[model samples]
Target chain A: MGITDETLKRRLDGFRKRMRDKEIDMALLVEPDNQYYVSGFRAISYSRPIICLVYLNSLQFILPELEKDHASQSARTDELYVYHEIACHRGKDTQFHRPLEHLLDRQPASSTIGVEVDTLPAALYCMLHERNFIVKDMGPDLMEMRMKKDQEEIHWIKQAGVLSDLALESSLHHVQPGISELELDSFGDKKLLEAASQQFPDQLIGFADWTCSGITRSFMPHLASSTRKLEKNDVVVHSRQVWVNHYRAENERTFLIGRPSNEQKYCLELAIEAQAQAMQVVKPGVCAKDIDLAAYHVFEKHGYGEHVQHRTGHGLGLTEHEEPYLRFDNELQLEEGMVYTIEPGIYVPGVGGFRHSDTVIVTNNGFESVTQYPRSLEDMIL
Target chain B: MGITDETLKRRLDGFRKRMRDKEIDMALLVEPDNQYYVSGFRAISYSRPIICLVYLNSLQFILPELEKDHASQSARTDELYVYHEIACHRGKDTQFHRPLEHLLDRQPASSTIGVEVDTLPAALYCMLHERNFIVKDMGPDLMEMRMKKDQEEIHWIKQAGVLSDLALESSLHHVQPGISELELDSFGDKKLLEAASQQFPDQLIGFADWTCSGITRSFMPHLASSTRKLEKNDVVVHSRQVWVNHYRAENERTFLIGRPSNEQKYCLELAIEAQAQAMQVVKPGVCAKDIDLAAYHVFEKHGYGEHVQHRTGHGLGLTEHEEPYLRFDNELQLEEGMVYTIEPGIYVPGVGGFRHSDTVIVTNNGFESVTQYPRSLEDMIL
Candidate 1:
């Protein structure tokens, strides 16, 4: 099942309370995840703009005509204003701006409007400014609200994590010296899709994977899976994120293929230790920085401090990387129901990058890991 | 091979010329495709802001610490300023805006800056505005440049088209009753990845597929593939896009699973005719509206004018949908080397959606079809 109507109602009520506190007459949401949180509608692509407007009492959607039926079925909204592209509908709303302008005209000229400052387009912001409307950033409010996952969201994320582990197992089982990175990812894709189909009929599921192999490619963290064949003794960083009903879980593992170097084994073990340390610090009321620092100290103690490049981990939910990051600078307190990935990594120049990522949920006192894939150095060697 | 250095130089020179003509001191590119076109660099994920600044004589990148090595190897830039998240790197450029501000401080207060108004975040735009600098839109300039594919770009797009066709054929081969939509997509994915790995070694290849099976889901044009099993007499619209080295080609086919209704067959044939009519009108110097209208007339003559919801097609290249769309209101003239997807579809309330998409390249006089998947009613009947 998708998100419950009761959960959606509670979320909308909370957002309206926030808007009232800020004395905002309207909140224009352009970020897809934020919109999906309030209204249960999402499109595969957003090359054509889709707007969600929330007021004190009701919500509205301004989308393309192509999404009319889909939004009507999924979105719990008060009104939908569709803009058409077909010639026969020329006399109607042909452009999104036309309907948007009409909606704005209905509101008071001096009304305060809230917008996602980080995602709202400059052109739209300029239009609101030129119209003499008071605009404030509601992006932070939405981020703060979405940081804590509800029970329904957690359920899907847990399912995604379980599915991810299965997919990772299938991919590793097919790992060999001659297989290309893309082919390696494909093996997992087939297993994940087939398993998801069998288990969760009628549910929407999606995934993204990145396999960076060899010393040169794996040293850089974020590279797409390519057609380069994996060589003997190559260190490969395989990252997979699976989303069930839009909630995501990230799972990553660094494995050694025919490795002979003692340094490579040491680095992989260090990464596993760092990830464990970070996961150990995940508890309610703990500072986000503490987790990062805990993992950082592991690498620093091993004389690999400079090799650490990114944060320990990032929050995972509707989007790939959400707010409340486990970074050294972040001081946000961990709360119950908050979900994040415990992934701390180090990349050495001549050696290879090593990291193990697992999704975990913060419970009343401690944290519970959703992904249970084997990540020990012995298990990682292929 | 990836993008050649000569192509990068030519693209940069063209963009700089546009900036010089506008008297803009610098152009800040935030869109991933635009950045890739100019700098030949792209990150797998951009949750952390990646800013590319192009000046009259030089190019600079301000990115997260994780992307330092990746960007260095790929981006053709003069300088790289990285912002860190780890605590040890504090007091250095800790946030993206800090480095961005440092770069801005070097320019004169009255210096003009160019930005992608359609995609630049409102917060960034406000920051630029508060700095007492004049900002102009360079998004259109980038779109205009990207509209006409270069020879090297076309080569990759062709490769993408070939891969897309092969993938579609694989999916269609596995189409049968009781198979889930996602399972259908996975079959194609497996075939595509294996073939791409064999054919294009050491290259980057990616794909996205959406299979909207049955009446209700098919009525909506854009929906992610689900785990809903196909039933007898189901109407399925299978859409796939394959990208090689960042260039994309879209391929789609609407097929019948078992014994479809006569109305379904007629609708499918009408969609095929509409697409053919639109593709036939794709010549240099022709207006974009003419192609859309040519497709629209096919449905109108067949008494399904009101059923059309979206435009005939959209430009396809680095982005899924780009400028110079095939819409009735858009009167932009088509040019040689322009690539577009000719997909003219109609969705009936009680029936289903019918559309066949093919990527085509505008030639000196006519057009060349890149995605040549079979579209006949007989060929589509599974």
Candidate 2:
């Protein structure tokens, strides 16, 4: 149903090996996704601060009292230190830092502590620094470990892809002039939930979507779905990410409403071709930059290179956007089991944005796209 | 419409005044909500580092190239330093830190900087520390400013509350034993989006929901809505947060399905009474703890105090949970225009969880409940 104990053990072992290599006595994980990767427990939000400390031989969780029971049932930890928020347990540990400090006291004064530098809050980092603990960044190590997908992770990602395809299909089916961007997104959301409920009972499923409709809105890369009604000749960039059991698969498409200009149709086809070119470059032993360049050349050859705003794609799994990004500057070699989104987008001020993203896993020789939604210009025009 | 330019100007002035009082020459905000509060712009995600710098005279934004157009349109910043990910802009700023370092280089070497210590990443903190800048926490100041909603904020929140009530009604109308928790949530989600699309044209509307059905699942709060089917005699805690233009209003309810036990009915009534007691204490000049204790007393009087795990309520706004928490240890006085969620619950092991949450804005004398979903036991029993 969730991450298996064996999987957690393997992850811990890999993390421990990296910790040893870095001479880190302990690793403090504050990132929710990183913590979930190691402890197999994730809270809805970290507004109260949930800290997962991974010692060489043991795992510890310092969490809010509300999550005490939930973490106990799910977390693969050796010790749990619950912090109370209510009045009844006022005298006891009421803040996460209290338990964290207590745990830090047990360690030798000179012990080097590892943390996800990019995610750990400055306040907590200062606490360790004040104690004279040698702090080191373990962010890259964790990202490297999580970059490659295991069989179990791939399985959930596949399920998410299937659900995302269903959602995209539903959204497209209901797309019409005068329907608001949010209303268009709602149709897919409803269908996805219904289908997921029927097929994957008892599994935790979540999704996020962004639909930027109209020339002005779609020209910008990121925006939430608003109540802006779709109009004739409007361009809409709809993106959806669905996750099953915490593994994510991103699926996005750019479509045109009635009477789209020839330029708009051409841009949509270019985006589709760019995505295909990027996906075709996905194979074991290929450089990540090669994938980005492959897609860039397509747009460059078409005289739309100056319009490209972002990188080709980003790694996908537990987080919305992880490391091993398919960027021109990233020289990381592609490997089997690594999953990425092959989305190459270009935004022209008057024409609008064009992009189609699909989640694909690098296979033994090439890549297997989990998201099989249609991407042709004919399929996209509504 | 978005935040008014005058409102952003006033917010900046207030923030600058706080900075002056604290002797902070410059303030760096990393938390998206805080950044948005000051700059009137927020990205979808911070996977790419988006730093907002606030000085006494001017505001600056350091963001990715992709967000340049988006920020230019939405942000009230005087300066923007765009960092590129693609190779074409390689000679220019290739990473966020490059621009960040350049910006810092312009600051006085011995200047003190205010930062949201709880939200700023350790990596950025270390960068500042290495350059010998004195860092101070401005998280409390930001929280204090955000705790009290302005008239414009209240307007959006009220709209969110109205939409939430409509969504809740739709979900309850479709509630059935055979429906999965995710399916239940979808009904509300669909209704909310559809209604929002019609009512608030071109405005950004978003929502999140958690449906914990059955005794075991309901007993533990904070779990996401899953593909678990509802059953007869089930206790379901359905929680929702709907936001309009980023101002949120939470509306939640605990309902009984098909013939709940007598104990379950009593617990639901007790929870409703506790919530009422807490709401009654929400007035200007009252301590925050008073609101919590008022609710705590109800459960304590019933000899079910031990069943309470979380605080009675939390401040509601852009973030899921913010400051001025209604906890026994928090003695901060409630002020007019402050918003809080009056959610008091008792999670009985076998009887299930009973809780109802409603967002309320503090008024001159008492409070105005924005979320007016029915809370009567008779209304809850299905």
Candidate 3:
């Protein structure tokens, strides 16, 4: 659980460089991603705010009293401040601002503190100003620093990829007729946990809510699960992606419930082929859109162009979805260690759709496919 | 899903009355909760920014092209506008400012727009002035408008409670040794999908990750699933609640894996009795902290006050953890129709912990308990 001191020092150097380029004294990270990136301390709370004070030389954390033990054990901080409600002894009405106020009181006076203006509340900004910290808004400078994945991140993502493949492998056996889509989804969830039980010890979102387009799957993303039970010749879709430390990896596959029709088989074949075609061009220095085009042209040649909804795929790393998406309009230049998904799907209303995607990492020469699931239509039968 | 015009008109009237008191016009709501509260659109793609352009007489929505169809279908708006990313394709990544800029351009010139300053980003605020709209920071005017739930909101929340209970009921049967905590948590997730299907699809921090106590359990409020095998004497805690359309129905239960020791039974009994005692005093005009003290006093009487760590609970209408917490410092007087959770726990470190909590609605006389799970320790069996 402890990151090497080298990793810590390198990130501080990166942040220091970014802050200097942006002409800021200190970067105040409020968003969960920035906090995790800088301090290596991730609170278990989903949406509860954690204020991370990062100066060039040192770092500090202010956490709720309940989470003090957690922060002390997890966060790489020079100092830790704990705040509690103290309501058990005091009968007077007090606002929930005491802990934050106490932190502000101790802040360096008139310091040019660069805040994540988007995440910091106006009230908190006012509170800081009242305490003599001149808050300056630092834009996406810190986020841009996180755009590229390092060695450890790439390793963790590779581990996540192995876990995703295991999930797909386990769930494939349960994709028979009479089983609900949710049951299939939960089955995949079970598989993901089984794979990561040792690595993460406690990992959630291993198998997230699965979205399927049984009959009307022509290019629509984010389909809600339906009560329509799997039947003979039903086209089934399942995605097993894990989100950890604000990073995400999504890999999807389409299957036949019992016996698929010729059209369904053709669609699945073309989709898989297109994704493979996209995978061939994912080398360092290639434009992200060209790889997207590599897949889009295949789908267009097969007359499924209009039906191919959604982008080819998205960058698969921190934040289930982030910058450098695989789309026609995206101008991002793919770099080594950049990980992304190349999913090409075709949906037709009331009929069904076919999708095949995998997470891939760009290598020096070409790329490495993180997903090892079978892509052939004949191989994906219940 | 369509609300009556009378109800809409009444809320609008109340909003106007509050606006007049604050001396602001054209309240601009960008946060999802406030947007849903005013415009009634539940967003799917959290990628696109959706804003509620509320004026004196009517409300309008500004959304990205991909969200137009879904947002238009659900949003209670008189007008809708869609912005693009330089092309006709949907969900294409452009700067998020493009759509936000377009919305400000369409607004009437020289009108005072009340911005939710706490939620609106500074970059977005800079964009507003560039588009000729005069922006004024409005404090808690919109929050005050949403604090009191209407009859319809109460109905939806109660339905959420029923669905949450069904999930807990289905999940309890799967609680046994050998199954990883993630699998146990997945049972609750599957049950939730079965109960409300689409209406209640979001995650309620329960299950999947925090099912078993190990290293993760030590990190209180763990949202991820643990790999720890449920042993004969282990205690499993579920802290996740159910959230439907942002309205929260908080509930938690601790289950005994197989046989329980005398201290374990004592912990469970104390937590339930304390929660019951707190629930007994909920009604109109009681300060929120008094209920917290009721639970605190019981734990103190049992000489387990130090172990009864976390705050009693908090207001649970929107966001699983919201404002007006049942803590020692809160002095907000409870009103009828206000719903919140009263979760009190006794943690014994590596020895495991016990908690019994439920969502309660303050009625005219006493209160209506929304969570119907059995509070008895004997009911939870392997």
Encode model 3's per-residue lDDT on A142-234: one tens digit a residue: 655666788877877777778778878877877776656656666677667665665675343344556563674323455444444566677
By summed lDDT, which 10 consecutive residues of candidate 1 chain A come out lowest? A40-49
DockQ for each numbered candidate: 0.88, 0.86, 0.33
How much is the lDDT of residue B245 in candidate 3? 46
lDDT of 1 by residue, A212-255 (tens): 99999999999999999999999999999899999999999999
Candidate whose DockQ is highest: 1
Instruction: Please state the CAPRI-style docking class of candidate 3.
Output: acceptable
Per-residue lDDT tens digits for candidate 3, residues B1-382, read: 4345677677777777776666666777777766766666756554456777777777887765545555656677888766543222546435556655665666677767788776786556656655666667654666566666788878767877887787888778777766677666667777775555444333222222245443236336444455555666677787556655456676678877667777777877888889988998798999998999999889888888877657788776755555557887678898887878888777776556677778888888889988898878678545
Against the native chain B, what TM-score does each candidate's chain B reach?
0.99, 0.99, 0.86
Off by over 4 Å in 1: none
Tens-digit lDDT string for candidate 2 (A104-155) = 9988989999998888999999899999999999999989999999999999
The C-alpha local distance difference test score for the whole of candidate 2 amounts to 0.93
As for lDDT, the candidate ahead, 2 or 3, is 2
* Candidate 2 DockQ, CA atoms: 0.86
